[model samples]
Target: MIQILVIAILSLIAQLVLPWWSLAIVTFVVCFWRSSSALTAFVYSFLGIAIVWLGYSLWVYGQTDGVFIMRISQLVFKANNAVLPFVGTTILGGLAGGLAGLSGYFVRQVTGNQSMSHTA
Candidate 1:
């Protein structure tokens, strides 16, 4: 709940200020500190990144009337709808965030942190 919100907000801020991969690093650090289980970390991080990306995409779509994104969507994915590009972007961000969270959990496991539990 609160943790997920924190992850999302921090990751979004990091993404805005740093490189795109900073979202993954932010999620990794946060999940590691929180000691979340792999599944919990992945799911929460995915949700956070997906939500932020979708919200940002929607904001951009509204601001641009979908002209730029729609063109790119058509060029890359051959998508005809104005919304498909946003969906694709959200999915991509979610997948990357999920993997980063999983990697963080694995790092904790390999280091013998032993704090992550099924209850997480």
Candidate 2:
């Protein structure tokens, strides 16, 4: 739980200060340090990024009345509903973070780290 929070906060900060892909890098590094299982890392990272993206999207939607997003959505996806693009954006961000987290776990495994252990 705490680990997920840490990853989310760090990823958000990095996203704000760095480029778009910073979230993936931050998630990768954090997951690598935490030594989580691939599935656990992916799920947690996906949730963290999805939360951040959705929150930010909502904030932007509130700020601009979502006109720009709606237009872009229409142009790119032919989406009529404003919410659909937001959902797609969140899912895309989650997928990126999840893949990065999974890659981190794999890197750890390749480097001779102990396999992630599950506990009940």
Clash counts for the predictions, in order = 0, 0
TM-scores for all candidates: the values are 0.90, 0.90
What are the lDDT figures for the candidates, one per model? 0.82, 0.83
Give the C-alpha lDDT of model 2: 0.83
Residue 14 in candidate 1, Cα distance off native in Å: 0.8
- Residue 19's C-alpha lDDT in candidate 1? 90
Q: Across residues 58-89, which tens digit of lDDT does each residue of candidate 1 receive?
A: 88888898888889788988878877788789
User: Which parts of model 1 have CA positions greater than 4 angstroms off?
Assistant: 116-120
Specify the poorest-scoring 10-residue window by lDDT in model 1. 111-120
